[model samples]
Target: MLKREDSAVSKPEIQKVGKYDVKEELGHGAMAVVYRGYDPFINREVAIKITDTDRGNDKDSAAHRRRLFFNEARIAAMLDHPNIIHVHDAGIEGSYCYLVMEYVKGAKTLKEFNKKNEILPVEKVIEIIFKCCKALDYAHSMGVVHRDIKPSNIMMTSDMDVKIGDFSIAQIISAEVTQIGGIIGSPKYMSPEQVKEEEITSQTDLFSLGSVMYELLAHVVPFDSENVSSLVFKIVNETPLPVSHYNKDIPEELEQIVQKAMAKDPRNRYPRGLDFAADLSKVYRNLKRPVVDIKEQAKFEQMKKLNFFRGFFDSELTEVIRAGAWEQYGVGEHIITEGDIDDSFYVIISGDVLVKKGDKAIVALKPGDCFGEMGYLAKTQRTADIVSLTPVSLIKVSGTLIEKMTVHCQLRFNRIFLRTLIARLSKTSEELAKYRPL
Candidate 1:
């Protein structure tokens, strides 16, 4: 016989919920216990969220929790997006109710990365938040306001994919509030309007997302306090320290994006999620370094290990990585031709290059060496014909892009280029001296 338990048991243990077998506990929150459930009928794994109505301090509070549980199911069912968690089914059996949702194995909350003492790579942070913006945009277009947009509610899969979940507190843009003067959501990430118990809109989500992004980049909540009242007060009246203040590595443009999104006045914040996403896109594109995707990131990492980029700041290195393309050439391939009018500089990442004066090979340049800079600097034709001595990997930087670098970055590059040129000249002079018979 199957045993049934509802409300409370001396030992709180659950084995089944509806048609799903609850295998193990995934996580527990103030109002629900999530389990890794197996759907026998569908032959698939799912996440079953069981409502804990006992979260309320009083009978009315318990009733409110129950209502919100069903509300979340309804709201989640209304959204369908790759970056938004999908709801499979919701049902109530006896005195228990559960929602079977997409079980993203190995998924962890963004809260893990939103700490005051640590942060992920800036490129990674930007990528994650950009996805969040797109997801929020879709939800807003469907007339839903995700009232509870916080770091913990955002999940990150093992492959770094993002999924926004837990829309239980969400409200329809046109619906009237069932709970008068009610303030719902994580206080720390709430916007000024939410703190003041004013009408909420899509801009509110933008503000919350900004707060989440701020924490990820700076490692601290925009507003922090020991008590709820003080926290709420600060949220409505305070301005957070610029993100760059905490992480000097953060660029001024990125900090400005965060500040604009977290503006105290909702009217001043981004009008739509699309607008917010656009701003993020602009910053990501304009960054001195590329954090665009995994492939680009791998290339950037390769540049960091090379000796030529040793003096470049991490930020400047990113600029260098984005300013050029990493390319490969086969042996006998011409890299530069004598008398060719071009100003592109090249750095040997691997393999070798042969520098030839007309028909004779003058030098064999190895990895970490550079070529064509003399012509590039002089804005003239190449003085030597350069060819790949073996299969080669190289970075070809455009003079046009290099000109756009920050003054400091450009100055550092020039210093290194000068040193390299001087060394090469000295080597050539010594070799020529030996040819001059006594």
Candidate 2:
């Protein structure tokens, strides 16, 4: 009763597949048809991916498609990450082979967001890709390499959580390719190494993720050509126009991350998934502007008064103020919590603040004095807590915005940053001299 009356969708639709009762067709692709199915044993719904090699294809092509189906089952079994689709069952009944996975109701592929009108907001894109990086990290930890990381393979549930599927071309890192053979991944998403038909590593997945990010933000693939040969050559030899070229509003830091992930040489890419995720986290935290209400002119006036910003022209200072977050904090509030991951350079506009490590107060800072210099320069976690000694107002500048400033403005900040570092080092030297004997 579960078998089809005819291999074609003609001759009265057949019903079940093994023990599961097929409901309705969800969607279909070249080699598979997905169905909304019910598993009576578990009383739960599932998505059944049934291999569909039509009567026209040769045996070789059909065999390859079947291998991909079973290979996905094997790969999915090794992965239990939240961001990956969970495979429930895989079976061969009569002439049919099918794989079942957790059904995400109203699930949609990221390909839906690739259009210009459908592009996601910048922060939302960052969050989605950040989750993807975490998933890849977990899979790579298990020695699995997802050879194909394309937009269509990434699913977004109704609730907005991401799930990466289609591990059909994925391979075990240390094993020989026995089932799914050849360079069989979407050309637009392939890395340089993949285009060259060379062995690849986890970094290839990162490259593919970068390609996906490019398309999501810019609404165009990084590399596209008229034919496969031209595309492969471009993947290996050409550089895409900067993402900012397409969407001027994309953050500079995000564009840099995209370039690095898609670097031609694998060695130049993020060494680990953790490393890639870390940078994305940084971008998410600092690049997003805080919602606030402050007159731009008033903020610019406050910034120009600071001795640190004396060299900036009125226009340059205006640009800096517009880029930074101007906010006020209550007395005794933590301005920068110790061990918090942030790279915001702050300048006290009014009131005083104190720097501390544990129970010890390191120093006191006043209006016109800037803090977070080392943290901003080093791009790491805060080493000490900066607490408002009194009700305070300050401007917090993120590194992402700084890159977009004028050359003169950037150079001035750099010079003042160096001067601050030198002054601190000098004070430390003076204190050390007290311990020295003549």
Best by lDDT: 2
Q: What tens-digit string does per-residue lDDT give for candidate 2 at 316-379? A: 8887776677778889988888877555699899999999999999999999999997776886
Cα lDDT tens digits for candidate 1, 1-438: 113455463223678877788888888877777889899998999999887555334688678767887788878888999899999999876445678999999998998876544468887887788879879989999989898899889999887889999988888887664632378889999988998888888999999999999989988888999999999889988788888888999978788888889999988887877667656655664463343243767777877878888877888988877776667778998988887754469898889999999788788998888888876688777888999989988887765557556899888878889999899889989989999988
Regions of candidate 1 where Cα sits further than 4 Å from its true position:
1-11, 54-58, 115-118, 176-181, 288-438
Error in Å for residue 401 of model 1: 22
For each candidate, the alpha-carbon lDDT, in order, equals 0.81, 0.84
Q: Identify the runs in model 2 with alpha carbons over 4 angstroms from their true place.
A: 5-14, 53-57, 176-179, 289-438
Which 10 consecutive positions of candidate 1 have the poorest summed lDDT? 1-10
TM-score per model over all chains: 0.64, 0.67
Question: Candidate 1's error at 9, in angstroms?
Answer: 6.7
Cα displacement (angstroms), candidate 2, residue 22, comes to: 0.8
Tell me model 2's lDDT, rounded to 2 decimals: 0.84
lDDT of 2 at 103: 98
Angstrom error at residue 181, model 1 = 6.1
